[model samples]
Target: MKRDIQSFLLYLFGFLLLWEWLRPVEQLTKTNHIEMFIIFILLSFAVTFLRLRWIWRTILKLWFILFSLNQFHYQDGFFQLGWLSSLFGELTNNFGMIFAQNWAGLTNVFRTLLFFILLWLMVYLVRYWLLNRKRIFIFFFMTLIYITVLDTFTLYSANVAIVRTVIEGFAVMGMLTYFRILAKENVTSDSLITRKWMRPLVLMIVFSVIVGIISPKFAPIWPDPVPFLKAAADKGGEDKAGTGVGKVGYGADDSQLGGPFIGDDSVVFQSEAVEKNYWKVETKDHYTGKGWIPSGSTLLRFGGDEVIPVFPIHSRVETRDESAALHHFMDYTHLIYPAGIQRVQFERSYDLEMDSTKEKIIILGFDSTPIAPDSYTVQFKVPKYKASDLRQTSVVDLEQINTDFIRKYTQLPENLPERIKELAETITAGETNWFDKAKAVERHFSSSVFTYDQTNVAVPGENDDYVDQFLFETKIGYCDNFSTSMAVLLRSIGIPTRWVKGYTGGEFLKYSDDERQRPIYEVTNNNAHSWVEVYFPNQGWVPFEPTKGFTNNVSVDFTNEDGTPAAAETTAPVTPVPKKDLEENSSKSKESDTSFTFNGIWLSIITFLDQHWKWILLSFVMAGGAVGIMYRIRGKWIPYLYLVQFRLKKKDENIGKAYLVLLGQLERYGLKRKEDQTLRNYARYIDTFFASREMSKLTDRYEQYLYHQKLPEGSWMESRELWENLIKKTIA
Candidate 1:
């Protein structure tokens, strides 16, 4: 009963640890589940200490069988069973971009399989050896140590290690030992070999480990954050604007782009415009503990084969007089651009085509536009009035949206520190409207009193609330904390706000030629940024950046000495090499060091064993020195088979010596036998001594030599055999 309880507790603890690991991803935390897990762990300890032999014995049997099966399953493509998204998540978290970025000639799948096989084999051998000796405590201790060390290295290096096999081996060994002990205690020696439970238990443990090792990829139903083109295709269609733009073109698979940066960091983008610019994409409305996520879902539909909407009002459109006009065309066929687009009036229009199948509107034109049109004209109106103007209208629904947003925005942890709430209140004490309150919070955060740094984020624990840590002790954090805290504050005071992540500041470039002048943009990860977007019901979403002043934004100027248009001058900091590039260099250096170390150690050991093998031989070595060294380094004990083999060799030589002497004695009695004749057969042929007790003893000795398994040199069987032969010779 006690052993059963212990087994139950071990399972319980494992469940709880898994829950803790998964809680963040699932966004769930249940106290009861945690408590139950704790109770199980406690119970397991109790049972282990109480030595519940039966329960342990049964558990061991179960674990060994399960683990063996797990090894077999892992040898297959178990880890690749999940959907694309799940695979991507696991890859990102585990392998990071090391494998993704470097598409080397190496076959990753085969490499992983080979590694797994080797690991499994190593574990199996070690565990088998340990179990045979009934060293339960040593087995468990080694297993735990191996797992801890291997997991730590895997985490640091972002790769799987052979340590997993060690764990499997140890568990199997423990189970085997427990079962062996139980069998010995419960059954008589004659029947112990047939214990029915042993084989099945070992099988179960092997199976379990095999299953655990194969992690399948699971594709999420919805597109992750930014919808992928492939995922959209799978889903039939995509809603681009989340309003009324049916999925037109194939969704772009951005999985390779690396999911949107969750933290605050700047990304640089080269731009076509002479002056640098910032492009904002979608924003966040809700704040999970780690980062911002959309608050609700939105739907979008597109008009098929219908004329695009056009307003009647005439509006003037012109290229800036300072620069040449850039001629562009607009094909409103299947393309779904952002909403609020007005007119396509250009200084000089170009040829255009709409490819329905491709869902693209292609336009061909000169890089630079002609001079400003004499009378550029367009028929367009702003999609929505500015927020300031909409504020004057008493719209109940708009007010509610704002109110609902604020409630969620300002949401704080139930057990947040009082000082954090006080600081928030003080920062926005006099702010009346939601926008003003938001600005106040931003201003306080942007102030010098709050620092911006990445390394100071608090580790997870009670009293380690993100906002409190960032606002009080750390006073510094990257975009994650900043965006999360701001979103919370805004929601608290009735503001409809969401966080947004996209490229921010970028370098602008312009090229001029005889045919035409143009500009292009190049974006880098340093331009990645996070900020908040408040919903001004009528005006839609407008972005607000509180961390802007913390980092310098590069700008460009395009002016001549006379203040007339010339060429654009770009200004920005020099771009740095990517982090992966540095890591690769570091890895190369480490590999060189490791190779040297391994060669040196290997040579030294080989030399030592070659020279000092005599001392090893003195101990009745059955195997070569190299094999002995290998066993010693790997912590595997010498096998009994080797000892038996050594003894057999010695006994065979002794028998040859005795045979020579016996032949001499037989010759004196005129019964000399050929080398091929057995001594006992010769004794039977000699009538004088055939029926004597001496003949029987001689027959016994000869029979032992011909049929009996050899015994060790010092064993009684070896001595007795020699004595019988001696007695036979004396009687003859």
Candidate 2:
């Protein structure tokens, strides 16, 4: 009876260990009502551990599941019997979705049901392992892997969890090993003997756990792999599916370019500027069908205050001297400058490396890395692109331009689909000049034709073109899609356009801070964006905003056919006005702009959400249903995986593992051996079923290795083939 009590206590403790797995489900994932999951686990243990009849156990589990479901969702009234019919209807619909291969269409109610089924299986597996197998190492190992993986991949810290799990896992594993020993020896369990064994085991677990907790570990030998993994997993210029929704930020790589990302409000910098403008970081001249890549750059090194020779002002475009100061709150070194930037001024002396082709600037300091300064000031030329100058650039007279310059900027991959080129031609059919052609392509991505989305964008496949995919199907994306599509579309028609990455004019905070003349703006990770810059002989590289709802804020002068600016169209800063009237008018205009901006933003958000339900549902289902499906189908998938995994392995250790996998496969194939049967007998039974002596021969080698672990080096090679042959026979 005492032995029975000990066994029961161990089983209960095992159930508690399983509870640790559920803790992360609540904390890490979107799963709610975790306390109810604990309650369900308790009821399951109560029914099974008491050795109740199978029918009674099933009936109680079903009752508790229904009661929990009602408690969780159907909070309409007492019992809420109405949900029963609704739940049934949802389940039917969800099952049809499953049959239709629409995994992303599964409902939350069905997801909850799948989770309940997962819990039921977990309880049954734990019970079976504890009683019949008398081993808990696999489940214990799995739990450790689960915790460590979550700790590494997610924000969950497993510091304390590691210690607790070590103590509890070791304790449970030791006790189970002791019980297995007694069972193997066919010895009756004695309370005093069990106490003697457990006392030392418990002491050993505690002592080892303490040592591990207090030990000074080595620093990590490798950097965290999560970022690289995310890069590969994200919709960037890589061979990966674009299903992930990463947080928006100033990412370094533009190679892999299409995927949805959530908004990040973390501040990257603060700026004080006369007027808000797009801050330029860098430009990429080459666009792989997948994403952007920088071509070879001629590095130009100079002092921080030295003038940058990029974007030389032509005779036609007008420019005004302007300066903006930025204070970075994040750890960053790259300078964010506006169009026609002349130079950056820093408090201390620093050298700079500027990429001629890419136009990326690096402030050099210690070890040749960019010098991360807290603040700097940039002087720039606020360009006023004249309407007549822009309209005069025709592609018909290409003999006047440099061939190398045209080839570099207007480069396209040879494999670029003809349809993409045809589409660009179609969009610009009515346009006369290069600027008009670019404008036509830009205006084509209106909100009616394309939706601005951060999450629903797709990464192009191995053979897919990024621009083609966005322009044809999945006409929903954020800046990357819109800008890249515009760039590619323009380039297809013999125009020079490049992709530019930088921050948009971020959210305005106050008119000024600490008596500064400029308005203070807070730029966040979400402000990181990209756009297209079309190069013209007279205007240099002109920036364009192709994404829906985004404006480039380019101040233009509607110059007449003859070089005269329109007096009525000139802005407040440029136009002459009475001083007092200017102040009052500017104040009222700012008020109107602020009000309209807020109202427009709120309305855009509402409209986007209303039109974007499919992606939202897919994301929601993927958050939980994917986990359930992975767990649910593991049994069916695992054996085939083992066959493939062991097939490539040449190590001798594969002998034992291969043999064990064979046993599992045989049992799963309805060839379960009796409890009293030895491996030799079971092997004989399997051989009889398959009409092959391979299993019996492999079992002899396996039993020999049990007594003496060292075997002939070639034993595994022979046993592996036999194991594969036998397991393959079981696959129906």
Which number leads on TM-score?
2
Weakest 10 consecutive residues of candidate 1 by summed lDDT? 255-264
- Model 2 residue 275 lDDT score: 75
* Regions of candidate 1 where Cα sits further than 4 Å from its true position: 1-120, 123-146, 151-271, 303-421, 431-435, 460-463, 507-519, 537-539, 548-732
lDDT of 1 by residue, 1-732 (tens): 644543443333333332232223222222122333333333443444455695684475334433333343334443344333543454454454455665453344333333334433443343334434544455345545544543342222212323343344444454555556666777443335423544555566667666656767575442222222122222112222121111111222211111111111122223333323333334444444433444454333222222323211112211121112222121112222221223333445543333321223333345432222222222222232222332332323644355555455445446656776567678888655555565578777767776443222343344355566666776655554676667666655556666555444333335645354555434444344456665554444444556523332211233344766432322233232222232245345546764443322333343354456688676556556667687554312222332243345544435434444445545554566676766656766653543445444545554565566553454434544544444344443
Tell me how candidate 1 scores on lDDT: 0.41
List model 2 lDDT by residue over 128-180, tens digit each: 88878878889889889999998886657888877777777888788788888
Error of 2 at 474 (Å): 0.5
| Cα RMSD (angstroms) for every candidate in the order listed | 19.7, 24.4
